[model samples]
Target: MAGKQVMLVGVDDSERSFYALQWTLDHFFHSPSASPFKLVVVHAKSIPISAISLGGPGAVDILSLVEKDLKSTAERVTEKTKEACKKKGVEVEVDVTEGDARNVMCDAVEKHHASVLVLGSHGYGVFKRAVLGSVSDYCSHHAHCSVMIVKKPMAKN
Candidate 1:
């Protein structure tokens, strides 16, 4: 069988996401004879300023600024991931989309023909997660392909 066609890694510039990316690269891409896989690191963002200020006098200008900032952040994140991939000798494609993280990730899975989705567990406590809705939780339940959640270890003394 052909190796997994693609693997999508969701990143938010968080430490957990970084660890997840590293773990995925080490476990899958580093292996000899591993299925030739395409790696994609995605940073999904939503700028409310752009969405909510459409009718104001300077709305267009403000929206443009918001988009510029969002794109800049995404580019920075992609660059960081790209550098890491280079250090590990893994080749990957990067994507930055403006939308809900869960939706963006799921869409990328389908758009990129990914066979797996990898993400970091935010490790929010039960109460907080219930109130805020964790992205990993949403992806785990909704993603079309196999999903892996890389969890950060609890701090120790």
Candidate 2:
């Protein structure tokens, strides 16, 4: 365990995130003479407060439905990611925490004592990027360890 490094990778249902995980596995975990490491897959799920608050008398029902949906989605995505890693013969720890994506990922890195954190950029335009903010960008600066943001390749047409 002395030389084992912990690698934290943020994953979701997005193609970009899946690609990032694949990239990490191919580039690092599958490399010859690669250092010993544990892959920690982190997925953040925020409560659907906005959806609940918008409804009037049916807020409770809306909250329940939204919560269920989000949980199922998160679980499905994490399972899929885990299965893919297993197929590659790489073991990973899956973390699904409820909080802001940026904060949750950063906290995961520190809590797990990861030496490196990897993410995938969504390639959002300026307007959307400014409006929604960038989780990867925020994590890159705020994470306790080194950060890697994998950019998705352009589609060849």
Off by over 4 Å in 2: 1-3, 31-34
Clashes of each: 0, 0
Decoy 2 TM-score against native? 0.92
User: Against the hidden reference, what TM-scores do the models get?
Assistant: 0.84, 0.92
Q: Which candidate has the top score in lDDT?
A: 2
On TM-score, the leading prediction is 2
Candidate 1 lDDT tens digits, 18-128: 999988888887852464677888889766664554896887777788778777878888888999899877778888887899899999988988888999988899999
Q: What is the lDDT of residue 132 in candidate 1?
A: 92
The 10-residue segment with the lowest total lDDT in model 1: 45-54
Query: Which pairs clash (backbone N, Cα, C closer than 3 Å) in model 2?
Result: none
Q: List per-candidate RMSD values in Å.
A: 2.6, 1.8
